[model samples]
Target: MTDPVDRDSRVPALVRLTVDLSALRYNYRRVASVGERTAAVVKANAYGLGAARVVETLRREGCRDFFVATLSEGVLLRAVDREATIFVLSGPVDEESAFAMVRHALTPVLNDATQLQWWRAHRETPAAVHVDTGMHRLGFDYRSFSASIFEGFNVGLVLSHLACADDPPHPMNERQVARFESIRSLFPDAVGSLANSAGALSGMASGMTRAGIALYGGNPFVTRPNPMATVAVLESRVIALRTVAAGEPIGYAATYTTAQETRVAVLGVGYADGFPRGATRDARVAYGASRLPVVGRVSMDLLHVDASTVGREIALGDWVEIFGHTIGIDEAAAWSGTISYELLTRLGGRVARCYTGS
Candidate 1:
């Protein structure tokens, strides 16, 4: 079937997202290596990489449990694998969605009394109960917590989210753990879970650990070495090249000026392509072993990078790695003062995705 990851560099894709499934699987094992029952969070289109393809790869690696944020995500996942455990993290809203959850055998992670009541009305399968730890985003609080809330339904998992799992020493981590432990203890029959990607590695997660961003090559530890292999590679084609003399202005409103005579490579990607409008630090692109600085304001469809350092070997249509095996997403995200998850999810649909290392 002509491999979907078009290895041919000649193909004219302005921007390409190379998803290394091998690295993804390796990352899965890396997170799983900590010995916690691991569940894959394949929400947000598997963090903007094609969920179907990524899930297919993970399934082969023996990942049977998956988590999604909404009914639509659960529905799409149900199409991918029928027997795998699919938990709708967002739970159900209306009667229709609750019924849809039952009909598909998809489990809902009940967050509040309304959702709990809604799921109970159409309970055909087991569901997860989310307890609020510290994020205050979803899950039940002390006011909502009651044995009667789960009285009649089958509770499969009792879980909570950590507001500061990325920062290991944060006091909120211990607080969430204590709260989550207390809630999980109330349900002896269901599996207890309180760790996310970072939680799993921290060795504090109980029962089952749910992994999200780390499974996709993101380093959950903000200040530590990324233990996982690089999984995502973003590359853009060099469509145009030019020479700008010293003090010459580049890009919109002359946001950047050339320090000396500089060669510029204008790539076919921009904020519209999920390249981060200006989140990049030093505004550089990778060429061979050299780093080319971005010399202008990032535009909607294009961005200019100074190639005077390695302009001799560069050519039109040659692919330049933006964030890849050599460049970590966290590193790039740091330059932009954002997290890897945001950069990964914010990646626009304009960029073509090609899976490799399957």
Candidate 2:
């Protein structure tokens, strides 16, 4: 008997995720151009696009600073680029993690007093301080903030997160900037970073911008047109085709009934592949310029698309793009009732990631 894994590798993948490294580099330059300096946020495995490749691609484009959400992520990234400054956003929860940060040369973003204490006790290298401006998610509270708390610490960076950076007109952006500025002044010698993806795009970044989703081609602004290039293209193969008569229900739960004769194409991708099941509502897949509406419920391993409009143009084994240059990721994410961040990060492991334009 042959090995199942080897046999599977011999065949073509049903689902393909093509990452455009050139486009990713383009996006980094575009975002970095808006601020004094920018750091790449490669957390969540670079938003499920693969961190190792994204880090290498960005490093070639002159990016030296990187950020991750956890100590393990920082360690993994440190292994990729030994010299790049990697900041752990979640900070150290205990003495062992702090020691690991020092061993890996990973800087911890001290979030609270306890984390600060941990870093101070195991202090071997400089650490960043995250001052809570308004997000209230992480970091030290700016309301009762005092520079004395970090009196003898070698604070390399002081940063804050913007809650409403996506909405340029939101007042919170202004308030956060003002508060962050006050706190940043305390660590005058340290680098000040107040911008995330949206903030950096909108020119709200201070000394150093932490670019996250925008680096992967996600739109930073909420209402404005996306200025970044498309970096990831998700495609799936058509495995089967069928014709449904009028009044015939299609797929599980019998949600969609054909009013007229319809041509259906079964795609080899489903919710299990990170194509959200909720996207069954007003979702679509594209073949060139033709858009095919997704009907009925999305299964764990399969989905049905109404391909009648294309007639016989689409055939078995034909590749249909789930989202890419033709169909924007943001638009497809909206159909799933989620954001691009969630959609990108939720990509299942079975999908083969192919890199191009390196």
Candidate 3:
């Protein structure tokens, strides 16, 4: 059978990033039915999947709340949808950043006593207060945060981070839930939020749930499959195909030496394109219905795939799929010794993004 035409003829550059809008909407719908208001965490460029576009699409789907990592991120997101309820996860640090919030009407997630004090003294701005349940990254210290901080601040929401909710039965999960309960009791007026993607799946009771990785369909827990699991794999065209003799090496460092004559195809992706270095010769790329194994160490701009098994005439400009429906995000993360979040978010900005329907 002849393979279908898969190349995007308009911009036939070296590479591109394809985003499935339908899959995104599907994932959003799948997780939004938990009875809690879901906010799409588009911080880190929607985990490097093009934040602006994702936000616009989600907003059209009635997603009013959006979370970002920094004031700058909030500003960028606001440019997309000014009316969206945007929260800065990494609360402001200086007068300028704090002022940006008031000017833009962006809500900052106050993480500490200092931020609370700054907000109280400078302006009674609309803001969210984060409680440090277990993650030592950001949030107010429950022991040190004085009641005065809560007394005067215009708290729009009171939220906490879940340390091990992905592990469900982990002790930290219960401890955090208990602590958050106390916080809720203390600030009953403020909207309570504590569940992240994993915590949301844990069936925790919270007012708002932040779906970070799950919005992109990366597993919130281990590398297992479950509901709401999808992946956005990038497919680049193969510009060249050739046959190599036995004992011939592939890629940098001559890391992969062919045992026999091998047919290899050069694909348009590399470390610079967000295909991690470790994914080198061990990773797999797809061409139509054929699965091609990567050969040699991955380069900064390109890599080779062994297509010896497919005896058909493999031509140049064939589409090669990387890290999508076939290869889950968790599996791709394993090749990099990192988590699915990193892989999804760290996708280089150079790649062009195209979205499909759910």
Candidate 4:
């Protein structure tokens, strides 16, 4: 019936997210090995792992092309890398954004007719052209797109998003490739591209594949093993210990009850720290090879884990591995009913990012 002790500063922050720069660099090389050239997709703050550090690492490793989802992201990357090429996937919709792109020396990936005309008229340097093969999200439709649309413009590359490259055998893969091939032929002077992380991993992406999820070591192929290095380690601290009586209800809404006299270790991470809010039985924290299974419902600020398996070896301020070298991101994401990209990107800002092995 005593209050839980706070172990702030002793553990050097409640949560520590370690990013392996060496692994990231290796992933870049692996992706580039498939395509002659590679464009690093660093959108969403490098999938919420800090784009500045990621960009600097890639730049040092000989990466020249970078892709971001917005003009602001492009500007942020431009500050980090002075000489590398920055491509804005989400092109400017207004005249001011186009001016910002020119001023920042960011290349816009023109998708629609409006973006096309704006870049055609205002772009001082070169810009990429996106033709819609099948994604139907961005890019111009190839059937209606004519050659005269890009006359006299400096088109650096023609790119398209694959609808089903992860499935490899999906008919959309061949269809998109064929369609993208025909579309890029009209602009023979421009470099052709039609792949993402999955495409790059499977060797389906041709001519300058843009890699996103795979860079952080997330498995791009569904049926095969993950070949990339472990680039990140998410961790939390054991704050309080309590003994729960058998059949005692635990956490919010009393979702779980202790099956026996159990030892519980409260961890300092929850929904606010990007751990799901309702991960009761499905979530588990790893301590070396042993798994500390989650016993109660997760909350906004904390989660409860059964430590009876560890006996008394676990103590206050001890670190618990959420996902790292031992636990794959895809495995953790699956337990949380989500994907690796969503899990990685949704990590809250409060967690401290510690880069290593640069």
Give all candidates' CA lDDT scores.
0.84, 0.89, 0.78, 0.84
lDDT tens digits, residue span 94-213, model 1 = 878999998888999998889987877765479998888778899999445776657778887988889999889999998888877777778989998888999888777667888898
* 1-358 per-residue lDDT for model 4 (tens digits): 0101222434578887889999999999888888878888888888877888888898888888989999988887888778888999998888789889999999999989898777766644798989998788999998898878787778888999998876777888889988988988898788888888888777676788899888998988777788888898999999999999999988989988999999999999989989977454667888768898887788887989999999799989999999887778888888878878988888886687887888
User: lDDT (0-100) at residue 133 of candidate 4?
Assistant: 85
Q: Which candidate number has the best lDDT?
A: 2
Task: Name every residue pair that clashes in candidate 4.
Answer: none
Q: Clashing residue pairs, candidate 1?
A: 279-336, 283-294
| Tens digit per residue, CA lDDT, model 2, 1-358 | 1111122446698888889999999999998888888899988889988898899999899999999999888877877788999999999999999999999999999999999888887554799999999898999999999989888888989999999999999999899999999888888799999988888888787799999888888888889999899999999999999999999999899988998999999999988989998874688899989988999999999999999999999999999999998999999999988889998899887788888998
- Candidate 4: deviation at residue 226, Å? 1.2
Q: TM-score of each candidate?
A: 0.95, 0.96, 0.93, 0.95
Q: Predict model 3's lDDT versus the native.
A: 0.78
Highest TM-score: give the candidate number: 2
TM-score of 1: 0.95
RMSD of each: 2.5, 3.1, 4.6, 4.8
